[model samples]
Target: MLYRLMKYVLLGPLLRLFWPAKVTGLENIPAEGGAILASNHLAVADSFFMPLRVPRRVTFPAKQEYFTEKGVKGTLKKWFFTGVGQFPIDRSGGSAAQAALDTAIRLVREGHLLGIYPEGTRSPDGRLYKGKTGVARIALEARAPVIPVAMVGTDKVNPIGSRMWRPRRLEIHFGKPLDFSRYEGLSGDRFVERSITDEIMYALMELSGQEYVDIYAAKAKELLAAEAAGARPAVPAQTSGARDAARLPESKAG
Candidate 1:
């Protein structure tokens, strides 16, 4: 009850006022039943903004730290996330990933909308990276349509290192649902996982128009952090001459 009230009456209105979002292709989202909204992660605010645009309550997996903190802040964080329908997922590898996948599958099976970012972390350079195969696995297991959502200009609103949000023009484009019914039972095969993941990433690439890097999100984050900290020497201009020479096309939506 609180979640619905807050979403419609308070949080949603305030977010729209500040961010001034323009949403497109909202009809692509299923009005009823279960589905997966696979989006490109560009900033921390992506989670909040995406949910506010969607009419139904979309539940996303949040890092366990949000729920494990201590004292007054911890309690507030727990309540806030819970009220917003986000559940904690242990991000550590091995059993944790499996557990998170299980939780997501259970939610979808129960007719809930599951929001997942295939990159698994916020993109540092605002470029879309390769999607992790977990999303493909879940979609296949749950037999849910995966809606590709692209968020533009969110990084400008709340870029990394900024303490507060800056009013910016945010736009969310929802691409037509990508159906993977043909790969229904092949979720266990590694090759199938990779193929499905690649397909999803390709659809996102068309929607987001960001340079696609075939690397995981964690590695990119580490490299960016190290570069920012000056621990690693900066790449000389000469070394990047080849990449610099190439003319990259700007995103039409951005």
Candidate 2:
């Protein structure tokens, strides 16, 4: 009830006015069945816009931070996320991945649309980075078809550091459903996970036209962090007269 109310009353109108998204190949979505909508994350608004375009109620795992807050603002935030059919997932690895996998399997078993960002996090530079194997693990474990979804121009409206949202044209293109049943018997195998993840990323690359990186999200995070650190300005050397005098005396003694 809350999901429907939020979709139709609050979010729907706001998105229509601000983002004005246009959806294509929505017919590719199964009319009634369990399926995974694997999307590339370009902006935070990707969550709201994708769900709004899909006819069926699609639920994604959102970070728990959105729900943990104090007072009226926290309450509203929690309510909004709940109304949108999102459940919380710890972004941290280890046991949190297991919990997320369990939730996704349950949703698929119940014949609901499970939305996931294969890239794990929003692309920091709008380029489609490599997808995490968790998405493949869920699809194979749940025996659900993976539908590749491409989102364009969302990053332009609300980018990484922007406080305000600009009205822009958003496009959502859903590719054909990809069946991974042939590998169903090989669940929990690392090879199968990597293969399936690669296939999903290939489809997304074709759809979104973003350069594909062949590394996982965790590794990508490390690389990006290292790059950011490397980009920082180097500290200047001290050139005080005392230091110069000491260096000159030490050199003379040597």
Find the candidate with the highest TM-score and give its number: 1
Residue range with the least summed lDDT across 10 consecutive positions in model 2: 234-243
Give stretches of model 1 more than 4 Å off: 226-254
Per-residue CA lDDT of model 2 for 121-231, tens digit only, reads 887766666677888888888899999999999899988889998899889999999888877677788766766776787788878877665555555566667777895
- TM-score of every model versus the real structure: 0.88, 0.86
Error of 1 at 218 (Å): 1.5
lDDT value for model 2: 0.81
**Candidate topping lDDT:** 1
State the lDDT at 176 in candidate 1. Answer: 98
What is candidate 1's CA lDDT for residue 159?
Answer: 89
Candidate 2 clash total?
A: 0
lDDT of each: 0.82, 0.81
Task: Show model 2 residue runs off by greater than 4 Å.
Answer: 221-225, 228-254
